[model samples]
Target: MAGPSYLVNILDSNHVSAPKGSVPSTTLALTYLDLPWFPSAPMQSLFFYEFPHPISHFMQTTLPTLTQSLSLTLQHFFPLAAKLICPPPPLKPFILYSDGDSVPLIVAEFTGADVDHLTANYPRDFKLLHPFVPELPPSTMSSDGILVMPIMAVKVTVFPNTGVCIGMAHNHVAADGSAFMHFMRSWSSVCKSKGDSTFLDEESRRPFYNRDAFGDPDGCNEEALKCYWHWISSWRENLAGPTKEISSVDKVRATFVLTRAQITKLKQWLTTQCKNSSNDSEEVKISTFVVTCSIMWICMIKSQENDIQVSTNGDDDDDDDTFYYLLFAVDCRNRIGFSLPVTYFGNCLAPGIIRAKKSELMGAKGIVTAGKAIAKKVKEMESGALKEAEKGPSNLEEMFRSGHHVAISGSPKFRVYDMDFGWGRPLKIEFIHIDDGGSLSLIESKNESGGMEVSLVLSKNQMDAFTSNLAESLKAF
Candidate 1:
């Protein structure tokens, strides 16, 4: 197998900021919800769009529009251009923005690259897509030795007459997926309007910056911070390690789709299974999301069964009793008992976790078992989004060591395909960060056919097994 042969030529690199005086100097405190994700990796995404025009045309026209609109968009989303100020120990972390703060944007061109293959649904070399995204600038030390990290960076890579990819890297602590998608749509709207934002409603154009909107009566903020410090004490190397080098492992990324009809079939099958089961009293709230995730969970576990057994040295008793977990985030903007604006920014996500024994999840009733567990966890969230907020960090660490776990990123409701920057909807959107193990990204289908797209990265052998398992499961449905 040949290594990635494409070369990326850096065309320009510069910083962009909001218009002078448009955004006042600000300091935003990190909420308890944000602190846990402070040490995690930055969220990286690549949005590909077809651009069947010459490079000269792109430079002469598209480049200026993108850069200018981004600057204008920052006037409204100024926090994205802010720097995260991490003071040592007892001092809490906060985002700071003053005069002259700006986001780093890089322009590049990929030579000898196939846009079609990169945008295809089939497996492709994971490393080949890395260069399209810009790396966040290295964290700097303040005069007092505090860590100062940029929150976001942007890169635009042109495939020269084939397509263009707008890549972004943003600190997850700065914003959750909901907030990030809001910024994306806002930026695209501005670019599409050729730098006019008046077309958007005031509520849509600006984010509510009041951190006080999120009430934390339980002192979860302080507790969450304690958890962060405790976790970081053991990972001192990762305190400023979001810029860690990309993995060198041989991996391939592939996209799979579950159409509306297929998802319905899975739901029907689950209903029938529940009706026939001895434990029919158990309530499983079946939905498109539940069924899709349930089927994926069953297939993923079956696909990796051999590897799990080998890692456990074929300890049948222990292996059967071992637990596998799935974690996903739920947007809490509306769920929390507060009148927070839907546009209120920062992280308002509650962790949704499901744990199932290996034997249960791999059984013939795996989908039913997984669905019941997931639906229960989600139902628990309805009582209070942050019901057990303080234990999140410790719980997350335990799941990581459990050896069999998966984290779901993005969401079908994001409507990522609706983001049109005058060039049209994105041909494909890839969540670059999911290449890290035990993660998958989901988004709405590009064709507006009410289907959902799931993307993940795996080794060749694992991908083959996953494909086979998915086919078999769907056939059963």
Candidate 2:
């Protein structure tokens, strides 16, 4: 499958536009939302272990298996993801979230390369992957006015031992993390089961994220839904305050395991700290995992210097002491209005945010406050769920008036554990950068040996601080 392969291509001029819909006309801003909002756009982190160690058999090829077709089996379960878009989702609708006139989907492209091709041929070290022509043709697009593609067509390259990585980027309006993972697995499952025809039948199109389980289109008022739109608009601009795009070395990834005793002590400490505190009626229970993250970031910053630094890589930039710490993700199965069970279809549900500054999060009390703050914000998301989004924000527009400054974004949506293509869980789950930004994920589960562990994937510099600070922070209580 080399030069001009048998793939569909949907060029912008040849494609149709999103069909007219009833959704609202107002642009939405994540910061403007009345309640705390998650991704201004729907995004996710997917983890996969290097093909489980059967050591005897493993190889990486662009197209792993010689199926009848070169296009991914993704066409099987998530054709929407890998196909091209004709009529793109309108740009204004996403203004609240993306902050730009262009759709993130069309702005990005997917090009595949063998890991060896990258290590040996590329002029640059294996740091980034760029866009290229798409294969899907014009037929895949819909007439809708929105340029929403269930799946973004991507070229997949194999990593001899690491398995295949299929690049996917879509309109943030369409899918979130959980939705993306379900889509990713469903897409790959079809590929692995090439011999089997029953994997993703028409029945699989059940609308997992909507009230209906089938391919039924939802009937909520599109304009009324902007209530959801305007709310997030305010959250981004108003309550969250302005975003600052500080520059720093890329944060890296790391993993650490803790004893049940260590986990318990940390949890106890946080609970006790919240005891006398008067915040919300909701119990101050904390996920041991969230505590680990706060500790991770604090240690991350401390190891670097007495205070965190924030520079936007600008030659004329001022003040270098601004930094923010992010907490992991939470499942929105219940958070969103969709009451359907967490199903195995296109992505469903959404997430909320948990952020703190470097100075405030330096010491023990600081970590506790940061973690607790995350819990509180998520809890707000729990109680209000969709309603909060309808309320909108008073101070929202000011935040993203300019397109810069988003600090550490964290997510703990680990779906690698739930997916099983018959080969049991893989040995290691790692995330490759598909998006430009600082991202951190926290997982709470047993490792390959059934022991507790905390794994972090972040920018390179953050990794150094995290390791040194973690060693000391872990010793503290």
Identify the runs in model 1 with alpha carbons over 4 angstroms from their true place.
199-201, 230-240, 243-245, 278-282, 308-318
Superposition error at 212 for model 1 (Å): 1.2
C-alpha lDDT values of all predictions: 0.83, 0.40
Residue-level lDDT tens digits of model 2 in 133-235: 2233222223443232233434333343444333443333344455556655664454456534344454644334232432212322343334444543444
lDDT of model 2 at residue 209? 29
Local lDDT at 218 for model 1: 73
For model 1, residues 91-119, the per-residue Cα lDDT tens digits are 88899999779999898888886888889
Each prediction's total of clashing residue pairs, residues at least 3 apart in sequence or on different chains, is: 0, 63
Q: List the residue pairs that clash in candidate 1.
A: none
